[model samples]
Target chain A: MKNQAYRMALLYDFYGEMLTDRQKEFYDLYYNEDLSLTEIAENYHMSRQGVRDAIVRAEAVLTELEDKTGLIRRFQERQKELRQLQELASAAQAANADPVVGDYLRRIQGLCEQLKQE
Target chain B: MKNQAYRMALLYDFYGEMLTDRQKEFYDLYYNEDLSLTEIAENYHMSRQGVRDAIVRAEAVLTELEDKTGLIRRFQERQKELRQLQELASAAQAANADPVVGDYLRRIQGLCEQLKQE
Candidate 1:
C-alpha cells in the first residue's frame, strides 16, 4: 500500500519514546493502526486540529531525532555494506577458491545475512 | 580512566542528536572532555544544579533511547556473534580443511575482528 508504516517503523523503532506518552498513544493509533485522523480525534474526544497538532509535533520530534542522531541512517548503511560483503565472499569463492574454503565463504555469507536481520 | 567517555561515545554515536544543542555542548565537555561538573557549570554560567540537571537529563535520554531501540545492544550482540562465527570458521579450517580454505578462514577471522572495532 506504500503506507507510511515502513518509515514510521524505522523512525519509531529508533526514537519513539522521545514522544510524550500521550503523543505516543495517538501516534500508534494513527500510524500503527492506520486509523484516520478524524477517527482518532473522535475516539480521543479532542478537536481534529488538536489531534493533528499532537501528531504533527510527534512526527517532527521523530524526524528531528533522526537528523541529529543518524543512527537509522548508519544502520541502513551497515546493512548495505553487509550485503555487499556477502557478494564479495561469493566472488572470492568463485575465484579458484579451494572447495573447503568455498564452504567457509558460504558460511560467512550466511553470517552476513544474519547480521543484516539484526 | 574507566570513565563515562567510552559509554558516551557509544551513546553519542547512537543517539547524541536527541539532546538539545545546549545539552549536547555541555555533555561533550563533561563526558567527552572529562571536565568536572563545577568547571562545566562555571564555563556555562549556570548554577551547579542547572548544569547537573542538564547532563542528567541528557544521559537519561541516551539511556532511554538505547533501552527502547535495543540498537546498541543488538549491535554489540552481533559483534559477539561475528566473533564466534569466526571461531567456527577456524574450527572448520582446522578439521582437515584444504590449505586454501584455511586462508579463507583466516581472512574471515580478520573481518570479524574488523567488524568488532566498528
Candidate 2:
C-alpha cells in the first residue's frame, strides 16, 4: 500500500499536468469522488484489477514526477522556512534591541500564518 | 539523494512534533536557511560527518513520522479531492440543468482554489 500511497501523493502533486485524459478521469473518480474501487470498476465497465492497475500505474507516474521535478518537495521546504522564520522573529521580539528586525519578523510571521491557513 | 529528499519531506510534514529543539535548529539552517552542510557542521561544532549523521537521522525520524501519522498525506488527499470536484462541476456545467450539482461544485472549486493559493 506504500506504492498506492506514494502514487496517490504523486498524482496529487501533478494532477494538473501528468495524467492522460482517461487516467485523469479514473483518478478523479477513485480519489476525488471517493468512489470505491468496485464502484470505479462498475462505472468504467472494467474489471476491478484492471481499474486497480490503472490507478496504480497512474500513481507511479505521479511519484516519478515528484521525484524528478520537486514541486511538492519545494512547497514543503518553503513551509519549513516560514515556520523557522516565525520563530526567529519571536526571538528577535524578545531581544527588544532590534525593533526593525522584530517588525520584519512579524510581517513574515503573518504571511506564514496566512499560508498555513490556506 | 532520495533518502535526503524523503527525510526533508518527512521533516517538513512533522516539523511541529518530532524534532528535538536542537535538531530543529540544524534542520532549519540546512533546509530553510539554505546553509551548506559544511556551514551547519561548523555552526554545530561537530565533524562534517557527525552533522551529516544528525541530519540523516533526523530525516529518518521525519520519514518515520509520515509513515505513522500521515498528516501530509491527508493534506495532499484533500487537494486532489478539490481538483476532481472542480472537473466534475465543469463537466456538469457543460451538460447543463443540474443547478444544484453545479452550485455544489462551484463552492468546492472555490474552496479548493483558495486552498491551493494558500
* lDDT (Cα, tens digit) per residue for candidate 1, span B79-98: 78778677766765665335
What tens-digit string does per-residue lDDT give for candidate 2 at A11-46?
464443446777778777877777888899998789
Inter-residue clash pairs, candidate 2: none
CAPRI classification of candidate 1:
acceptable
lDDT of all predictions = 0.77, 0.59
In model 2, which runs have C-alpha deviations exceeding 4 angstroms?
A: A1-7, A97-102, A114-118, B1-118
Per-candidate TM-scores read 0.76, 0.42
> Candidate 1 lDDT, tens digit per residue, A19-41?
89999999988888888888999
**Tens-place lDDT digits, model 2, residues B13-78:** 444344667777777787778788889888878888887787777777666545644557766764
Cα lDDT of candidate 2 equals 0.59
Error of 1 at B70 (Å): 2.1
